[model samples]
Target: MGGEYELNFSCMLKPYKRVLLKLSGEALMGNLGYGIDPGVVEGIAGEIAEVVALGVQVAVVVGGGNIFRGVKASASGMDRATADYIGMIATVMNSLTLQDSLERNGVQTRVQTAIAMQEVAEPYIRRRAIRHLEKGRVVIFGAGSGNPFFTTDTTAALRAAEIDAEVIFKATKVDGVYDADPQLNPNAKRYQSLTYGHVLAQDLRVMDSTAIALCKENNIPILVFDLTVRGNIRRAVIGESIGTLVGGFCEVS
Candidate 1:
């Protein structure tokens, strides 16, 4: 742990100027089985605040799995399109809650939705979103491309491309990607870095195929790291070799 801290500190020399963070709704659940956990959201907000303090522009795309999962509902016999629309609304709720928490932390924030809801959030405008980040405001994108078929992962990739973020930070429960599920396989190997083709060929599921292909086409690197660890966001932003980097190389440990 001490050595890890040293490495993280030493890598602070080259922080990214702009980044897109992908946070799953389940991550906001903490120990709860469902719904948002205020404490967890507060902790995440604080960490993002630290990154903003470093002058790094941050944009977030949050998932809605905790509140509602469209794919599951669709599998259960509901109309796929309707279920997905409901899922999008769930993401909006999450975005609002996150916005509230971020504002409480004194970090300026903007909630932009692909599906326009004038009463609550601004409509998704690429230029305006970029302007918000340039002015030191954290932008939260919700509603998943304003369509039923696309997942939030795809939305993250799309928004990242539109804003020209330097990198995409995929915050997950696990520390990094592995050859097998570490929980089930004691001998599972963790990958330190991977190439785009490798991820798709192996069906690693780092992100959906659409999202991965989009990032690949846009030439954006993705760093998959453990968000549960305190300060991991800032650590990643500072370029610490702390997660599975998916772009331009392949290595496993």
Candidate 2:
């Protein structure tokens, strides 16, 4: 627990006014074995609050890997589609938890689900979600595109395209995409930037192929960074040199 660091926006290069942040359910687990960790959620909310205060509109898509994974269940002999629906529900749970933490941090938030759960959240509406962001509310998209065989990463890309997000901020356990597993190879090379074609051709595994292809098609930039760092989210938003930037137009410098 440390005090929030004040970002000097004057020194920062903010290339994105609006961003879609993709958070994996496992990111909320902290040091626990499973499920949401309140402290971790709050810390993430705090970082988000900082970015919101900086006038960066943020929309989030949370994955359900911590509670359940659809693919894993399918491997265990469960019906694929049914297990995927269950996984979507798990994402909704994570979204609610994150929304609660963000609200507690005094950040205005809206939770929109792909599957209509009117009692708990607003059904995903692209127009309404954009309106919420324009009004400075952080909108969270849940339920993974309301379909089986798709992922929250795909949801993030789809929503970003729908909402006209300037970039996709993919927060993960690792700092950035590397040529080899950094954990195993200490000398693994981390790319500061990568082309979508390179990622696809090399099979970087930074994101699902479908998700990567979707982003490549839409020409949306993806910034893959470590969520464990307290201020990394804000850093990513402000365009600090922290993570691997993929599939964006680079101006001649």
Question: Once superposed on the true structure, which residue ranges of model 1 sit more than 4 Å away at CA?
Answer: 1-13, 248-253
Cα lDDT of all candidates, in order? 0.90, 0.88
| Cα RMSD for predicted model 1 | 4.7
| Tens-digit per-residue lDDT, 119-178, candidate 1 | 999999999999999999999999989999999999999999999998899999999989
lDDT of 1 at 175: 96
**What's the TM-score of every candidate structure?**
0.93, 0.93
The local lDDT score (0 to 100) that residue 229 gets in candidate 2 is 87
**lDDT tens readout by residue for model 2, 1-253:** 1012112223334657999999999999988889989999999999999999999899999999999999999999999999999999999999999999999988999999999999999999989999999999999999999999998888888999999999899999999889899999999988777777777888988788888999988888788999998899988887788877777655122
Candidate 1 worst ten-residue window by lDDT: 1-10
Flag regions of model 2 displaced more than 4 Å: 1-13, 251-253
Clashing pairs in 1: none
Clashing pairs in 2: none
